[model samples]
Target: LPRRGADTPSLAAKRGKIARFYLAHASRANNWDLVDLSAPYIIGRWLLYPDADGKLPDRGILDTLASHSDLWHQRIGIVATLALIRQGQTADTLRIATRLLDHRHDLIHKATGWMLREVGKKDPGCLLEYLESHFRDMPRTALRYAIERLPEPQRLYWLKRQ
Candidate 1:
């Protein structure tokens, strides 16, 4: 059974172990059905321990879970990363968000925008700077999200560019 507390070291270790176990299983598990079981475990563990110190995951570690190319896993990863940013881990999130924007996947594009929107909520000027630089290149959905919280007039102005 999954543990209920986030603060316990033992529980944290257990979650990490579960996540690693599922990740290993995902590598060998051919059925997409089995892959689903690992998805939540991996995402849950990442949510539990976002790398707030800005250390990228080791290459070996990333290789182990490379199967996360699955759309569902990418979506969950994006949501978890955004949740971290919303919780005020802006510096760390900025690193993650920047990398996500380079992803070719459309879902990741939207997720990057979602995180940028939260950053905008904390500092609208910063968002505007990013928008001014990237709006023309960003996916429409992403651009809209990054601008969604702006004042009515500002929102209309950006929307007009669409």
Candidate 2:
């Protein structure tokens, strides 16, 4: 929610300005807390909803972030999916999560797994279906985070798949 009921372009402009600043300084603000705090509410939310002009959200920005060599940028991209998850919009999260499944960093793994867990909260079948297909290749930390909410038996089943 940028401005609740109002489609004020000034706020939109401000948001854009903030995004630009972040894009430039993401490396300096490489701390996990900083990325987690802002990317979701600002970047991710912008990707899911129309602004004042009623323009459709552009997902290409996410693709850019995901494909970047910077770890924080990639984390920002995956964690930004939190906005979609909150709105019962898990598709983007799922799509982005898949792209980072084989990532080498634990931060990406935890973020991906956390997003997957959130997706399970909204749609268990969706998460289960994904895990069923990719659990073996998934990192142990990620698999643990992703299956944290499942039943004991189901959790065991997924973990054993490793």
lDDT of 2 at 70: 95
Tens-place lDDT per residue, model 2, 20-122, is 6777887875878999998998787677656557675688788788889999999998889898898898878888887888899999999899999999999
- For model 1, residues 89-117, the per-residue Cα lDDT tens digits are 55544555554555677666676677678
Which regions of candidate 2 deviate over 4 angstroms?
1-3
TM-score of 1: 0.58
lDDT of 1 at 6: 42
Please report how far candidate 1 places residue 14 from its true position, in Å. 2.4
Q: How many residue pairs clash in each candidate?
A: 0, 0
